[model samples]
Target chain A: MIEWLAARAGWPARWLLALLALIMLAGVVILAASIGEMPIPLSVTLASITNGLGITDLPLDRIQQGIVWQYRMSRALMAASCGAGLALCGTILQALLRNALAEPYVLGISAGASTGAVTVLLLGLGGGLIGMPMGAFLGALAAFALVILLAAGARSSTTRVILAGVAAAQLFNALTAWVVSTSANAEQSRSIMFWLLGSLGGVRWPDVGLAASIVILGGLICLCFARTLDAFAFGEDAAAALGVAVAPVRLILLTVTALITATMVSIVGAVGFVGLVIPHAARFLIGPGHLRLLPASVLIGANFMVLADILSRIIVPQQVLPIGVVTALFGAPAFALILYRARPST
Target chain B: MSLEGHELRWMKHQTPIVDDVTLTVQPHETLGLLGPNGSGKSSLLQLLASLRTPDTGRVRLGDMPLRHQSRRRIARRLALVEQHATTEADLCVEEVVQLGRTPHRGPLRPWQPEDERIIRQVLERVGLAGMRRRRWHTLSGGERQRVQLARAMAQQPEVLLLDEPTNHLDIQHQLDLLALIRRLALTSVIALHDLNLAAMFCDRLIVMHRGQLVAEGTPATVLTPALIHEVYGVTAVVERSPHHGRLQVHYLPDLPPA
Candidate 1:
């Protein structure tokens, strides 16, 4: 495997690996879509997606088509893109911040998004999930501003940034709890808590469109800065000495990752662990080079999320588990094991 | 071309750390910045390297001010090896060395064969010829220092600034590193704690006392017993060594400077 990734083969091999990942993701998507109640046939599921995508014309009943394309397919795509965006954010954050444990939400975007989402849900600000993402976007940007402002006094060190993020997370968590406890009764608060845990139960075409644009744009921007991010793998001084405009570039990349991560949280309600663990998992398979690790993390995260969502839907039969719970359940242990093994044992 | 500082002053928490330091190094000369801990040697070196901007003074490379040159331009011409620099993650020696070529490449430019050749040559020059794939955390303290030196050399710099590069090295590696720095075809400013080593390795030595350049000249003239006692707060005897015909300093045990 190392020989295959060696520079003797280089970019062509990377592209080939990416192509294989893409093919596997497509296979997973079709398979995951066909796993719901009523058991849509794989052939019909493929036909429905291809037809919905306008690739081909096929005979299909209206209800089955709706179930396959409108419901299952849309949810799967949202999971894929959200996963990609979150994983990409995590990868960039880990490198730029010079910390392996730095996750997508390390800058407090998810906490802020949760605050915005809870506010909208309790007070009926946007009346539904529609305005929730808007609130999340605004709150994410605001919380990020606060983190930067709080950390600015500390000389922009990584420890300071993470600490500021933790502080912001606590502040926003308080606000979320206050809103939910005050405005929402027991039934409404239960739904609010479930949403906070993250759910993809009601995903539709608009959610996919909204998330895909940012994920693709953000991923492209990250790709352009892959070499700069690689420079950061050493440290800030080394990166600056290598001609990276340290101050501005770090601020821009942090904001860029926040933008993508905020959108993902709004869509998926703060899906956990994909952002924290998938990047490290990808790094283990491929070495720490951002050029390869960035793309590998995206593909692997997408696949992992799609599978998790499928399991969430099918686990208890008519009682869907929140996707966040599923990820946290599996992701936390996997991450701990990886961390234990990766570090030198002194 | 010369690297010069004009009235360089730096302050931390309302206290001056580098106090009005003005110095210059001729092209291809080895100038040692010798001072004790917190005596402003690192601060002054950082000011000269363009890594840290002074509060009241400016650094000039040739006719241009340090700020006038773009960071890429400065990086191409100047390289600094920090005293305690370490990678946050495990990277192979080759990967670490290849990062030195970053200033020369950009978004569109790919890594070239010439960069590869330079990396190979520097690795061999540093006596790490077959250790390209060695992990950073696995290397000894001395090997890490040599890796840093190789990285600086790969920058193709016109001027190099090193802060305590030999701090953790064995005696042999320390001597070898200084000799290599002297032989390199560039101007160098190295900070050293060992006055005798600095005297032997440096073409000229600048002694700092209380954030001031107390003396500057050839090692033989600058490293007098009185100056060493004054700056470093230790009674020392300075004499010419017959073996190398340069100034050698021997500190009196438990004796304080008067």
Candidate 2:
């Protein structure tokens, strides 16, 4: 049935699916937001969201309103944004490299962010609201610069760029581990470990606003290049013959992915598997056209992250499981299945 | 109007690979580019198509310098079918042909009726009208070659550049492919390895020897016994065929390691 639906979907049907997914995602997000220790009802959660939007009066008391509006809703939005951003980046990277397995981290941007964030958490660089994310974004830019320099010096093959990224990731990951292990106190170590594993606790409204804007804006910019990305499926020479300026397209996409990775990592600390897994699943669901795949991946990824966040909260009776742990628990098996199934065709 | 280049040169690793080449393809001419291995046929096609920039010279389409035209403008008027064009995606034949419409449309333009019409006509022209839904990985080598041709045709180009297009084709498909190119009556330059095929279909033949134009003229004027030996380093007899009235080259086998 899903195959029939995917095969029959025209432009109108695809847009309709996106619209339906958007509506379903809204319901899922609200229901998940209602699932915590406070245990607000779905009616109250919807009412709370509507009341905040000035659509209706507050149905819940002050404490209930605060919990839904100030805490859970913002966290949910952040999860959706991060998921959308990471998956979109993965989709672009895969096309750019022409490798099915390429993800946001394959370029070492996230590893560089981890190193910077760990250093800030341990040594207290700048020691304020602006310091942590700023440090991490800078680190990611530095690593990306190194990657570009290295790739330019070589033959400019996609494999060579990927190998260069692997080297950079190893170096940055080692630096991150050293920083965390040697300098962090036990209490700091506990908090750092939870974050490294992907925590979404205490992500307030400001982070949600910033992240959602970047994701949506970045997605729009990427959409403008959807045809160009499709041209790249046949490799750079074919794309060039089709009037795409290959170097600029590649460079702009790399910068965009790096920025997305840096921002998401700084906010939620390296939420692994979302980038790698969501895009492939979306590709399977929708045939791999970027114009369709981009929107579908965004919606599907948003749903996945929100559900994972909900599962993390409800798994332990009182404690929150790290979101990355839950994603990896599911993502690894799916990744293996994608690889195993891919062997007979190519 | 013609598509031509002047004194074009390109270097690879500081060594000249396409050195000081100049040529012309008159309107509706099927110019055959013939050369020995490493003799710059492919490099010259790339330069003419503006897929590669000349280190020191210019290509002109009609009266305009190619560098002055936008990439889109150049692509709309010129199409190139490379020797081994490949795509890793699981696209069907129709989707692959639709890609040729990229230069004709902008990011915001919806796929139009005219574009669809062109796709359908080109697929039919290449004898793949019924195979539009077939996936790329499932096709045979000759089918893939025809799909590439269909794609190039869909570009609606004024000048079509092809590099070794008959490399993977069966002999029948090879003949059919050349026939289709000739029937289309587009300004085309084809790089070919088969000397007799070039002799049979091409309006004029240009021979490249060591990155330079060694000879250029009508098929009868350019193809000769001595020229084949000089250009290909092989002994060959050339005579007009009774059936087609074109110079037919029959190559002599090499003497054993002597």
* lDDT tens digits, residue span A1-346, model 2: 6556777867677777788889888987898779899899888888888887788986578888888888999999899998899899889887877766567576787788887778776777776665777778777877787776877732266566767778888888888888888998888888888887778987999998888988988899899899989988678878888888787888788778877887888888877767878888888889878888888888999999999999998889998898888888888787677657553323
Best by TM-score: 1
Candidate 1 per-residue lDDT over residues B83-114, each given as its tens digit? 87666566889888888888888864788999
Error of 1 at B127 (Å): 1.8
TM-scores, chain A, per candidate = 0.90, 0.91
Candidate 1 scores a chain A TM-score of 0.90
RMSD of each: 2.9, 2.7
- The DockQ assigned to candidate 1 is 0.52
Candidate 2, residue B255: CA error in Å? 6.2
Who wins the DockQ comparison? 2
Model 1, range A1-346, lDDT digits (tens) per residue?
7434644576778788789889989988898789887789998898899899999999898898889999999999998998898899889877876766667565677888888877876688866656877788777877877887988732366667778888888888889889999999999888778877888978889989999999999888889888888888657777877778777788778878877877887778887778879987787777777778888999999999999988998888977899998998998897687557555311
Model 1 score (lDDT): 0.83
- Candidate 2 on B1-258: residue-level lDDT in tens? 489999999998998888998898999999999998899999999899888899998999998899856777887888888887666577889988998999999986889999999999999998999999999889987888889889888889999999999997889989988998899899999999999999999999999988889899998889888888888878888888999888898888766886
Model 2: CAPRI class: medium
Computed on C-alpha atoms, the DockQ of candidate 2 is 0.53
Candidate 1 CAPRI category: medium
